[model samples]
Target: MDEDYDYFQELRDFLGGTFHQDISSPEQALDEYINEANKECLLFTIRYCDEFLTSNRTKQEKENYIQTNAEIYFPAIGLTPLIWLNNVVEQIKEAVKLK
Candidate 1:
């Protein structure tokens, strides 16, 4: 990756800059469900995941990073830590593929 290639920014751009919105929900009007706290929490998680991916570290190292921050980052989201981690990883992978 180039020095200017930011995974967090890339992910945000791929998401049309609403990286905090509920893209997973199938609701017709998302604004009805937009919770400020939830959005802030998602932003942190996404930024951490971006750090995970862009670090280019080994699997063990990445998992360690997540585990270390698990308590801080995984509480606000409704899903379990493992599920949220997997979903974010998959989403970022798909985003990378698009580029």
Candidate 2:
């Protein structure tokens, strides 16, 4: 995809497509739940990117870290954690390239 893709927009689109019915505002409870989950994933991605940039971890180690943490991050969001991580990593790489 485009190098300048917005991870949050991709995430929102993924959720909207996957859980279209559940995301409807009429389903207030479910909508709120999904929103919270989306927020958590976005927050986690930002923090992980910052941490990855500062850490001395090797690329493999960084991938492993994401793998290990996938369980915690994927439960509510429903997307496969590895896929989400890969997208986030790509975004981070692109950001670094522009810096």
Candidate 3:
């Protein structure tokens, strides 16, 4: 979990910095970039989880990693991070259901 936390913390910081530089106002940013941001977040989460699942980790570990990182990564876009994170989680769940 520590390793997962550290990896995601670094990813979160990088993405957060990028978003901060790209968007000046949260409202305007949401209006213009929400879809792209949400897509990126969802893709990242899915890819990360998929890769993690291929590793030696258990299913619970993969789930824990996703949940832990969601709190960090989803908010990187600077426009209602928690809400975006929730939306991303919902999207992920829906995708998993289709699989």
Clashes of 3: 0
- Model 1: pairs clashing at backbone N, Cα or C within 3 Å: none
lDDT (10s digit) by residue, model 3, range 1-99: 223454445445533543454566534443343344455454555554344445676656645554444334334555344344344445565654544
Q: Which pairs clash (backbone N, Cα, C closer than 3 Å) in model 2?
A: none
The per-residue C-alpha lDDT of model 2 at residue 59 equals: 64
CA lDDT for candidate 3? 0.47
* Residue pairs in candidate 3 whose N, alpha carbon or C atoms collide under 3 angstroms: none
* Model 3 ranges with Cα > 4 A deviation: 1-7, 10-79
lDDT tens readout by residue for model 2, 1-99: 345755444544443443344333323433343445544454444554555545676666655555453323355555454455455556544444443
**Highest TM-score, which number?**
1
The ten-residue window of minimal lDDT in model 2 covers 22-31
Candidates 1 and 3, the one with greater TM-score: 1
